[model samples]
Target: MSNVKDVIVKLTDVEKEFDGVKVVKKLNLEVRKGEFLTLLGPSGCGKTTTLRMIAGFSNVTSGEIELEGRNVADLKPNERDVNTVFQSYALFPHMNVEDNIAFGLVEKKVPKAEIKERVAEMIKLVQLEGLEKRRPAQMSGGQKQRVAIARALINRPKVLLLDEPLGALDLKLRKQMQLELKHLQQKLGITFIYVTHDQEEALTMSDRIAVMNDGVMEQIGTPDEVYNRPKTKFVAGFVGESNILESYVTQVDEDLLHISLESGKALLHAPGFKNEEMIYICVRPENLLLSETKKEHFSIRGRIVEHVFAGSVIKTVVELINGQKLRVARHPNEEEFEVGTYVYVYWHPKKAIIVHTVEEQIYNVIEGTTNRIYEQLGEKYSPSAREDSHDQ
Candidate 1:
């Protein structure tokens, strides 16, 4: 409904506490007009709390919320010009699809003929043309969600908030809905603030993602940003699979930081480190390469302890000489490495990410440096660290 070049919504220093426990800490975020933004985190991470604050269902402890350059912190929920699609589908049991979609219009005092036309268009948009007369209970899970979405979008609100609208659907249906929602957001050009703990769903739909943890915002970026360049140990471990190897930073130069790992010494070139402190190395499972024979380049020798086929990729767990376990994910096409097989584990320097500890100052520094590095590196950093020698 609007161009993304405009700033549609803004939340500054937002916080919420319930029963003397802080549920949401100070959070600042901006929703670009017509952008699809998702609040992604586990339960109790304050995603729902943030959504409620925007919806006016919960009081803001302290902060300012602006909608289209106007302050809405003091406005009532109905006056904010935003609609929400709940996970429960909150459809009236007695109402049919058309009536459900038309309810918001009716409350706004739209004329009867225009209401009917809008409802008809919504039903067609959701591909539920012939099912307008069916009640919520009569429709399947996917259909009911469609009705919920249709109802929310029919109001032409400035922003639409969805709190895990697809959580109740089956696996196949949830995937289908993710794609549909993405397409819908792009087609309608309406600002969407979606909330969900399903990482895959967030990755699949959001134009940008705000990852929260322990009542605080962890990282905010595009899906690729959060996934690839995680700022903290929690973000790196929580967002995806990673082998977090604790290492000591031994040297630092321009665009390169050498570190010593427990397994052995290797060359690490992470750009985030300025101080030669103990840092954790984050390497994705897929980034690790498994070799039957040792190459002339940097590598660690380990024994394959287990091989688990997980549908799309094969997980090979290796025990290094120092007894640290490293996981490697490879495509299913390669010959499998069996249990107890000895192999060399290696990855390119760019695949390694040097992670600082989760202290407040360190966290802030990492968060601050990310944008600069991204502008310079063109993506996430690929870092490697040096170690003393291989043990096992």
Candidate 2:
């Protein structure tokens, strides 16, 4: 865990509303200095909205956005000590890379000599040594992106806001740029708040990831923690390929949970839960093994529906008796298990990651079996009073 005092950017219950519709809920986040923090989620999940609010492009509906303990939520874009880089690589089409990078300094009316010196340093930092004369039209996608980054870094802002800056690059070049950007962040020791929907990119480039869904932050942690120990079903499904199983807890003893799985019962050692709770548990594809011979403590018989071979590994999709799909990933082997063959899916007891969340309230809402909502609203659910048309 990072020290709280090292925080460079903080958002406390920050919100955004457009046309009376809330896009970003009350979100609280702390970005440590010099760390690459990526806000990762699907489209329209309010990640870009969050970034815009931080960059002062979008105003916060309520709460505070602090930089170095000073609230700048209502500051203008130029008034804040931060810069933004977009996916479009919004560079001047007429200006060369050198002029584009020196735009900030020129606007500030800095000395020409100092501007030239700083632009040179920026070019070297982004490794655009001889491409200074190349314009946006003359440069490739990768080069233009570097130029844009160079322009943003020229100002030396306390935090750099990159909104899917690599979204326009090709796959090979995107992979290469991911490494370059990570290295650059490390070399400069500057705070980076990145936004991307690509999970692999987020895992590769981010020191920490904030997983968002439906305008709400689901989970925020390191890559391993977010991937391995997801706190919610949304995080589990979004972070990577996972097989989520719905189970009902029938008994709980300390850290041990006895759950009713499928038509059978199983014992899980995950801590924290209540009896009769409908919970979600997940396991990664690699953790699950498909075998013909069943010799395990826990195994579910399933039929192979499809197999995908992607060079390094083979993905086998299995359909269980309950119609739920499960996937298993492993290196290529000499196993001749064709599609439609029956196999057993099994994993160690501890491989299951029990999703711990407040979703029980949602389940209550769905089932319409709880009076908690009425209690909160200072009322009681007395359906029986209306059971007989105002009579006994």
Candidate 3:
């Protein structure tokens, strides 16, 4: 159990509206002190809107925001004990790095000696020690973003809000900055609220992630919780690569659930569902097992139609007897399956995440076409296909 003393920020029934569209709806969240929290979602999902409301830039249409046990609803942006690092970095081009970092101290009327000390400390903290004399125009994208973060941190605000601070950097630089920022957050012990659309970035850095969709929060939990046990279909689809299989509930008892797929029946052990209705099952890309032989209870035989080589993993697309296309990921070093190889697919029951909705017919048509292509290639060509391929 977590304690209130650990909570640095809390939102209760928080909501915001723009021109009568409910951009944020009845949101409840708690941020532990010194934790790195991220608001993650695609564009127009209300993640940015929610962050702005907390920063005091966007007013809350309803609900309360409490920071360190004080309601800050009436406070202006500058008056609130929070600082924001924008995507643009927003550094004054004319000001040198040292001065830009010192600007906040100057605004607060800190003594000259103290401001100098703080600026120097910030430069070292962000590992920009010797670059203080350079102007924003002279810095690299990563360096400029570091300067922006230094500027925000110099004030020593109770909370820091970062809005896609790494968006402008290239892939390599973005990944590098992610580690730097995460380490910096842990060292400083300041509550950090970051916003981004990148699911991988959020999973890599956040202590907890709030997944929002279409102006509503889908789920909020640790990366493991959200990733492994998504509460809704939107969350399952949005967070990572998932293969959703439509299934009908056949039996339900306590934590164990039995479901029947088009190819075969399998069991799921999620505790929250019951009543034996229709549901959807979700399996992660890596959780799926690719096999050459059929197994008891947990098996589906299919013809491999497409094999794509992604850098670290090989993606195999298989079509089951019922024309269901299932994707499985395997290591590059593993034996490669050809375009028309017949194989067996198996996955653990616990690895499946049962969902409650049906997929569109378009999926069926796309999968159906792939299966037919494999069949047309002729099954007698392969040594192993004589028994497996023609049986379908």
Candidate 4:
């Protein structure tokens, strides 16, 4: 973990617009020095736009992009202490590896001896010593990526912005590069801001992840926190494979809440919820368990509809009485049941993630009046909102 006092890059209420449409909205992020922060989302989620604004490739309509406490709102790409590596290894086709990596120094009119020394160091750093004379056309995808990353780092910028730099490589090479990039970032202690639409990629390379959706930053936290304890339904669904159930609150105790799902009910440790209110809870497939016998207050009856063999684990799909489906990941040693087997689905109470969905979003929205809004969700405006406020 990077020290809290070592913030190298900070974005405050950043907003960007294309024509009349807002693309990046109210984005606030603090990137610690040496932290590998990844912007992760589906396409058109403004992740690339956010990266461009930080790189000065795209202008922001409003916000403060600060580097080491200095605002960079009007700074040009070359002027800022930052460099970007794009998905396409944008190298000069005719130039050799040495020239390509030394372009920045050459443009800055550095002395020939210094440029030669720095270029040699970079070539050694990327393990391209013998390939210095080779052109991009003669190198592999991974090699060209190393060249691009080397060029981007030659200037020793305070931060590096990567817009899916490994996107063009094959799956095997991409996975390898993820480790290599992470190793390089840690070895150099450079703050890296990466943008990608791949969930697994973000989880693999990121020290922290910022989940974006429809131009808004949905959630930002360590990979484990974001995956295991998502505060919003969007984050829970987008970050990984999740089994979210639509249910109603039936009982609320000191630190436990009972929820009902169709003909089934389960108890969770989520507190501060009103009885009879609608909610959504998320459970990862690995956490979900299936059994032949039902356990009171924990298991829900469901029929096994299908089994998907996915190499590491077999995902068994169960259809509930209300037509909702749930999945349980079976270990290799576990017995595989027939497709039509009737089983009970349950998990540990602490594993359930109470996520805010449309029902929760409507609480803050007062259409005609606050009373009408509360009544619509069958809520009585209880003090539960105070607990939800802490999540915000």
**Top-scoring candidate (TM-score):** 4
lDDT of 1 by residue, 309-391 (tens): 89999898899989999888988898787788888877777888866555854566775686466457743342221112222
Reference-based TM-score, model 3: 0.86
Residues 231-268 of candidate 2: C-alpha lDDT, one tens digit per residue: 88888888999988888888888887777768335556
Ten residues in sequence with the least summed lDDT for candidate 2: 379-388
Winner of 2 and 4 under TM-score: 4
Candidate 4 Cα deviation (angstroms), residue 344:
1.1
Per candidate, the number of residue pairs that clash is 14, 0, 2, 0
For candidate 3, write residues 1-392 as lDDT tens digits. Answer: 36989888899899988899898988888899999999999998888788899899988999999988889988999998899999999999999999999999999899999999999999999999889899998999999999999999999998999999999999999999999999999999899999999999999999999988877777789999999988777788889888888777777878877777787766767775655667777898788887787665555668889888898999988888899888788898888878888877768768988643223324545756765765777675443464476688
Cα error, residue 199 of model 2, in Å, equals 0.6
Model 2 clashing residue pairs (backbone):
none
Off by over 4 Å in 3: 251-256, 271-275, 299-301, 321-324, 356-392
Model 4, 1-62: lDDT tens per residue?
34647988888899998889998888999998888999999999998889888888888898
**Distance (Å) between predicted and true CA of 158, model 1?**
0.7
Candidate 2 residue spans exceeding 4 A from truth: 1-4, 250-258, 263-267, 274-276, 356-358, 361-392
TM-scores, one per candidate = 0.88, 0.88, 0.86, 0.90
Those runs of model 1 whose alpha carbons end farther than 4 Å from true positions after fitting are 1-5, 272-276, 292-299, 360-392
CA deviation > 4 Å runs, candidate 4: 1-5, 358-392
Model 1: number of backbone collisions: 14
